[model samples]
Target: MRGKHAPRSTRWPIIILVIIAVILAPIIYGASSRNRTTKNQTTVSKKTSHSSISSSSSVKSSSTSSLSQSSSSSDVKLKSAWNTTKNKQLSAFMSQWQTEMNQTYSGTYDGQKPDYYGISFPTALENGRLSGHIKFDNQNTTVEWSPNANSSAKNQVLAVAVGQTSSNGYNRILYLFIAQEKQPKVYVSQTTNGEDLYFTETQNTALKDGFSQIYNSN
Candidate 1:
C-alpha cells in the first residue's frame, strides 16, 4: 500500500512540471517573433526613404543639364550672327564700284582710276540697320565714305551713300543699292544731278529724303 501511494504522488508532480513548460515555451516564442517583425518593418521604411531621395536628386540633375544645353545653343546663334557679314561681301561691293566707276568716268579721274582701297566691316546698328565704310584713292587723293544698308520687311535692300572729305565733313550722294520687291535686281543709283537714275519709277524727291535719313544717321 505505501509503494503505490508514493509512485502516484511522484507522477502528479512530474505532470504539473510538463504542463507549465508547454505554456511558457509558446509565450517566449510569440514575443521573439513580434520583435523580428518590428525590426523588418523599420529596415524596409529606411530603404524606401533612401530610394525616394535618390530619385528626386536625379530629376534635379536632369533639369540642370537641360538648362545648360539651352544656354549653349543661344550663345552659338549669337556668334553666328556676329560673323555672317565678313570681308568677302565688302570685297564684292568694292569690285562692283570699280566696274561702275570705270564705265561712267571712262579712262580715269585726275590721272588715276577710281578704286576702293579698304573697307570697314559692316556693323549692326539700331533697327536692323548695317553701316560700313569704303575707302578708295585716286590721283594721291584718299576718299573715305560710309554705306548704310537698311533691311526691311519685304526683303528690300536699301543702301545709302555717305560721303566725307577732309575739307568738309559729310556729303550726300545720290546713289543707292535697291532691289525689286520679289526679284534680285540690285543696282547702284546713277547721278543725273536732277534726274532719278535707278529704279525708273522712283522720284528724285523721295530719293533725296531717303539719302538724307541715312546721312543723318551716320
Candidate 2:
C-alpha cells in the first residue's frame, strides 16, 4: 500500500506546469517592455531626422534669397555708375553686339565714394564702335570719351584728350570707354575742366601727349 498508495504522476505534471508558468511570466513582461521602449526610441529618431531635414532646407532657401539680394544690390550699383542717359544708351549699345549675356560681376572702382562696384559687360566686339559722354556738375567740363575701338583705316583706338584739364590735385570727370581692339581691351579715359584754370590746359596737353604715345595714327 505504501508503494501502490503513492500519489499519481499526473499531480506532479500539474505542479511542474505551475512552476514553469511562474518563471516565464516576468521574462515575457520584461521582453514586452523592452520592445515598447525600442519602438518609442525609433519614433523619436524619425522625428529628429525629419526636423533636421526641414531645418537644412530652410537654411538653403534663406541663403539663396540672400545671394539674390546681393546680386540685385550689385545691379543697382552698376546702373548708378554712369549717368542716366549714358547708362541707358550704353546698355542698349552693348546689347546689339553680344552673343553670350550671362555674367556674374561685382567689384570696386576708384571714383565710387565709400565703395565701388565692378560691373561686367558683354564680351563680343564686332566690326563697330560704341561711344557716349558723361557730364559732371560743372557746366564747362564735358568728358567726351569712347571705350570702343574705332573701325577706321588704321583699325585702332581713338581715345584723345580734346578739352582742357589737369591731372593734378583737381577732380576731373573722366570720360571712360572700353576699346575692343583685340583679345585684351584697353580703357580709354579723357579729362575735362573749366577754362579759368590754366592747369586744365596742362592736364589736357599731358593727356593728349600720353594718348598719342599709345595710339599714334602714324
Candidate 3:
C-alpha cells in the first residue's frame, strides 16, 4: 500500500499547477476574445467612415455640375442677344440713311386687286386705291410709291434719291423694296432736285423703330 501511494507534498504541487492552469486559461481566452471584438469594431468603423466620405463627395460633385450648367446656359443666352443686336449690314446703312416718311398707307388691300392698297396722304399724284377706284384700267399699273407698309421685306431695304418726276410724283414712285444688291445704286424714282434722299438722322431713328414695330406686329 505504501509503494502504490505517492508523497503528499508531490501531489500537492501537481494540484496547485492544475489550479493555476484553470484560472489562467479563462483569463487568456477572455483577453483574446476582447481583442477580436475590438478589431471587428475598428473594421466596421473604418468602413462606415469611408462610406460617409464617398457620399459627401458625390453630393458636392452634383452641386458643382449644376452650377456649371446654369452658368453655361446664361452665357448662351447672352451670346444670342448680342448676335441679334449686332446686325452688321443693316446697322451700317441705317447709320447713314436720312429719309423721312412723307406718306402713310392705309394698307387696306383692294377687293378687286388683292396686291393694291391706298395711301393716307400722298404728296405725289396718282390714280390709285385711295381714290375708291378698285378697278385698274391698265393691267400693268405702277406701284405709285415704294416702302409701302404692305411689303414684307421692309427690314432689308434702302431707298435711292432720284429727282421728282415730271408728273410731280416721286420720279419712279413705282419702285419696289430694293434688294440688297441694288441698295447702293441710284433708284429710278430718286428725287430730280439732285438733293440727297437719305433719311435725316431723326427720320432714320424713327424708321428703324417703325420697322421694329412692324416686325413685332407680324
Candidate 2, 156: how far from true, in Å? 20
Query: Tens digits of per-residue lDDT for model 2 on 1-218?
Result: 38767866678889999999999999999999999999999999999999999999999999999999999997764443333343334344333312132221111121222111111122111211222222223222322232333232222322221111343423332222323232212232333223121112223343334333333221
Model 3 off-target regions past 4 Å? 1-12, 81-218
Model 2, which residues run further than 4 Å from truth?
Answer: 1-18, 85-218
Please write out the lDDT profile of model 1 over residues 162-211, one tens digit for every residue. Answer: 22222242222223333333222223322322211222323445333433
Which residue ranges in model 1 land beyond 4 Å of their true spot?
1-8, 84-218
Over 4-42, each residue of candidate 3 has an lDDT whose tens digit, in order, gives 676556788899999999999999999999999999999
lDDT of 2 at 196: 22
RMSD of each: 13.1, 17.4, 13.7
State every prediction's TM-score relative to the real structure.
Answer: 0.43, 0.37, 0.36
lDDT of 3 at 71: 100
Q: Score residue 125 of candidate 1 by CA lDDT.
A: 19
Please identify which of the two predictions, 2 or 3, would achieve the higher TM-score against the true structure: 2
With a 3 Å backbone cut-off (N, CA, C), the pairs that clash in candidate 2 are: 107-118, 147-177, 147-178, 147-179, 165-200, 166-203
Cα deviation at 20, candidate 1, in Å, is 2.1
lDDT of 1 at 160: 28
